[model samples]
Target: MDNDPQAQTLIARFNKMKEKYEEVERFGRYHPDYSTIMKEVRVSKREMDMHETIAAYKIKETELQSFLDEISQIVAYSVSDKIMVPMDGALFKDGGCGCGSGGGCGCQAS
Candidate 1:
């Protein structure tokens, strides 16, 4: 990993949060279940909705953490590769990014 302090802190936080989220999901999956019929169900509808909401949020958080992990990997590799470029050029368009054609900037205006 790169020696950058900010990157290290972010990666650590993301990893910790991701682990906690996984634990919650595992608990939900292992919880006991019961069959239901036209008579009635034990769990309240509102309680079920809340549980579903929490599960959805956990799923999204895990996905975002996975993306952050991939970015950290790329950054570490880039530092080792010694490949560098101007920040501005890497981010902003140079206005002539495309010409009168059907590709690039797609400015054919046909």
Candidate 2:
């Protein structure tokens, strides 16, 4: 992507959101206090959603809708496949790794 200041700023915001979302997801997975941790996760998800909406608005206003839309689709597909689907499977199944990495460090196995 070009080094446009607005695009750079919006990309930084999205990166921050992705990091925060991953942190909350990790906490929700491994925290000892499940109930409290999930509450925090829910709050964080809502905040991320609000930020995404605002970012969409900013992109639209600046005529960066196509750029943002393409990036958003990639991010959404990745998050859905890597995080959401695995989380749902873990909740429903026996909580095994779905990536088939054979218990490697990729799955954070000790």
Candidate 3:
């Protein structure tokens, strides 16, 4: 909702991907030769691999978007004080440095 250009771009991309998926679904459902076309398609190994890669990326993009949406909701709730626990310091024990027993870089739990 903010005037962030990156967010706007991501939203646009997501919308375009959704439209493309709908179009593909419609085509597969209505086209008489849809199965035949898929069976007869003669793609090289590289092309097939790229297609798989693109599909995987599309799925990951959707998952990442969902995660971001969840995170945004959590942040909104936190800002509104709907969440009781303070997320910042609630992860550690005794408010001490979070270094583990090894105590190297304070990156681990003690």
The numbered model that scores best in lDDT is 2
Return the lDDT, model 3, position 8.
Answer: 48
Better of 1 and 2 by TM-score: 1
* lDDT (10s digit) by residue, model 1, range 1-110: 25545444545555555555555556564533212211122233223324544446557876786677667658877788443322322223334324543234534322
Worst 10 residues of 3 by lDDT: 40-49
User: How close is each model in CA RMSD to the real structure?
Assistant: 15.4, 13.9, 14.1
For candidate 3, write residues 2-102 as lDDT tens digits.
35454445555555555555555677857775554443332222243255444466578767866776676688787884443333223453354465433
Predicted structure 1: lDDT: 0.45
lDDT of 2 at 91: 25
Task: For residues 25-59, write the lDDT of model 2, one tens digit per residue.
Answer: 77775656656555655665555445655556655
**Reference-based lDDT, each prediction:** 0.45, 0.54, 0.51
Residue 40 in candidate 1 has what lDDT?
A: 20
lDDT, residue 36, model 3? 47
Q: Looking at model 1, which ten-residue stretch has the lowest summed lDDT?
A: 33-42
Please provide TM-scores, in order, for all candidate models, with all chains considered together: 0.29, 0.27, 0.29
Backbone clash count, each prediction separately: 0, 0, 0
Which regions in candidate 1 have their CA more than 4 angstroms from the true location?
1-50, 81-110
Decreasing TM-score order of the candidates: 1, 3, 2
